[model samples]
Target: MLKPGGILLLTTHGDITRQNLLPDEQQKFDAGELVVRGNVKEGHRMYTAYHPVKYMNTLFDHKVTVLKHKAGTRQSWGLEQDLWLLQKGNS
Candidate 1:
């Protein structure tokens, strides 16, 4: 939990992840839930969660003040990411 006035930095998958989703996984992505996939390596899995800017703003409404929100590209990972900086409210 964050104390009042504390700032939080968050990162999550962006729309690019949705574009790369497998045909079967598209439905799940459309439902606004995180998607998990088993890795080729044994006993390992990957998790992805995407959040639109609008949704993120609404989510923090009355909770935190959004200081910044941006979309970033990770070429090495072939994925786009959302970055958010939020500060806790005094209340």
Candidate 2:
């Protein structure tokens, strides 16, 4: 577990990826759910886990202070991801 006041930074598939999700996956994502495709290799482009903003908020809400949330441009071979900067807190 992270120490209190510790910082955590990470990125996740976002807008650009969302545009390519299947219809059902898109529906679930729009409903604030984490969409994970587990059939392929973990780090492969086809096996990504799309993280929506609403879902992420509920996932880390009250546990960490959101320092920054930035949606990157097309950087991963025309695929973009979102970056999050958070600080652990006493919740």
Candidate 3:
């Protein structure tokens, strides 16, 4: 639940779909066959969803009034990420 003037912020990663992976990434996928196969990574979660910017718009369209959208690098992992601030729309 949110108040009328409350803010909602979301921070998430970029496209992680198979279509977004590069050729070099495909090679890494093949290279990891033996050592990393079927094994979980050190810090990564079990389940994750990689949504594109377009999908974000689709998901939040008409549901919220976007106040600000920003993209920047994460200092911890040095990975790029997206930040969205939105307010719930009136019914």
Candidate 4:
């Protein structure tokens, strides 16, 4: 459920390169052989999954119209991160 004229803002890691942990880094931070820290953990630089904008648009079609969409990378602390902003239609 949503309210008329209300805003719905959502964001996610944009690309595979912007998410996930690197192999060696994951190994160093692993609690076990098959475990890794959180996806945004420090030194993690791999993405295990990708949910491109096209997919998101398809998923939201008919259910919610897109008012605006912006995508890009964010740099800080020598790391690159993804960003997105999506809005629902005003009714």
Angstrom error of the Cα, residue 7, model 3: value is: 1.5
CA shift of 68, model 1, Å? 0.3
Collision count for each candidate, in order = 0, 0, 0, 2
CA shift of 41, model 1, Å: 7.9
In the predicted model 2, the residue pairs found to clash are: none
Best by lDDT: 2
lDDT of every model, 2 decimals: 0.72, 0.85, 0.59, 0.51
RMSD of each: 3.1, 3.2, 8.1, 8.9
Off by over 4 Å in 2: 40-46
**Residues 1-91, model 1: lDDT tens digits:** 9999999998876556677677767676666545565564577765545564555666789999989877877687676577889999888
Evaluation by TM-score, superior candidate among 3 and 4: 3
Clashes (candidate 4): 2
* Model 1: CA > 4 A from native: 23-43, 74-77
- Residues 1-91, candidate 2: write the lDDT tens digits: 8998899999988766788789999999999899998766566655668988899999998889999999867764787678999999865
Candidates ranked, most accurate by lDDT first? 2, 1, 3, 4
lDDT of 3 by residue, 1-91 (tens): 8876668998755433323345664454334321122224577655444445666777778778889877655466656667889998655
Per-residue error for 26 in candidate 4, Å, reads: 18
Error of 3 at 67 (Å): 1.0
